[model samples]
Target: MSALVIQTMQPDFVESFHQALDAVARERRYLSMLEAPPLERLRDFVADLKHGNNPQFVAFDGARVVGWCDIRRHDREIHAHRGVLGMGIIDGYRGAGLGKRLIETTLAASWEIGLHRVELDAHADNTRAIRLYESVGFLREGVARDAVRIDGRFVDVIHMAILRG
Candidate 1:
């Protein structure tokens, strides 16, 4: 693999990004999405992020996207200081500190855009992710019992957040 490059999302990355996201979502173990949305929809979503100045970062090895992290700010006036984060790393990239790099990059960008808080939900079974969130200063807020059904199996969701000064 070439040197891993992490950068803000750009138009040229659309297709590879979509493929990477779809691969992770299809794993059915971590993210809420059992499968990725259509490519056009993903394109629109990335456009919205760019237009809104929301933070979205993609990690790549040469031309292939390996992982991504994004934080979308709330639209309501009262919630404007907050953003929700979402991220995923493809199979081969999972435990090598890539998630840390992607998330911290996105979080720094989020703070720059005047967001004071960032939130995320993780599958209760994803302890590795939970620990990563904690390392980045996110505190566990609460858990929703059986909040989702994946593959006919109920899963609890842990809500967590981090506040910036």
Candidate 2:
């Protein structure tokens, strides 16, 4: 495995990013709550990469993009010190520590931007993700009951948060 290079997302990488996301979405059933957005919507999504103090990062193996993570600031004033995170890695790249690196990089960037806490939600059934979050000091704050419907069944989501000192 080549060294994973973490960098800010660029416009030219949108298509590759979308392809990687689609592959992961189809395989892991981790993000089953949402459908893959259209290319145009992805363009808009990428356009908001740095909106309102939000930052997005992409991981690459040589010239191929393997994963991405985004940290978006919370909207309310009371929660202004915190942010929400979303992440995904392509199918073939899982279990290679790339996800951890992606998350660590994102958290480091978030802390640098003055965010004191980062929160994320993962499906309760996603034990791999849960363990990874726990390994990085994210604690289970609560459970959102039936928060998402996947494959005609309601699935609970585990809400987790990591605070930076």
Candidate 3:
């Protein structure tokens, strides 16, 4: 892999980002989707993120998206101070500190935008991601038992959050 760079999500990255997302999702062990949503949906999603200045980032190798981290702010006024974070690194790039860089970059942007809280849920079995979240100051709030049923198996979901000072 070439030297990696992380940049805010942009309209031009929609297709590559969609491919990267689908690659991770198809693994069926990480993301909520078994496949990426429609390309048009992704295009609209990118447009919304860019227009709203939401904290969404893609880690790239040359022109290819190898990983991504995004914080989508709540739409309702009552919850506007908060956002839900999501991220993934393609198979080859795991354990190389790409996740850390992607997350920290996105979180810094979230703070910069005045978001008061950022939250996420991870599969209970994903201990590496859990540790990473803890290292970044996210505290475990609760466990949603059997929150996800995928491939005829059940997994608990760990809910966690970090607050901006």
Residue-level lDDT of model 1, residues 90-146, one tens digit each, is 998888999999999999999998999999999999999999999989999999999
- Answer with 2 or 3, whichever has the higher lDDT: 3
Computed on alpha carbons, the lDDT of every model, listed in order, comes to 0.94, 0.86, 0.93
Model 3 CA deviation exceeding 4 Å by range: none
Q: Which stretches of candidate 1 lie over 4 Å from their true place?
A: none
List model 3 lDDT by residue over 34-114, tens digit each. 999999998998888878889899999999999999999998999999999999999999989999999899999999988
Please tell me which predicted candidate would have the highest lDDT against the true structure: 1
Candidate 2 ranges with C-alpha deviation above 4 Å:
32-34
TM-score of decoy 3: 0.97
Worst 10 residues of 2 by lDDT: 27-36
Q: Which ten residues in a row have the lowest lDDT in candidate 1?
A: 1-10
Top TM-score: which candidate number?
1
RMSD of 2: 1.7
TM-score of 2: 0.91
1 against 3, candidate with superior lDDT:
1
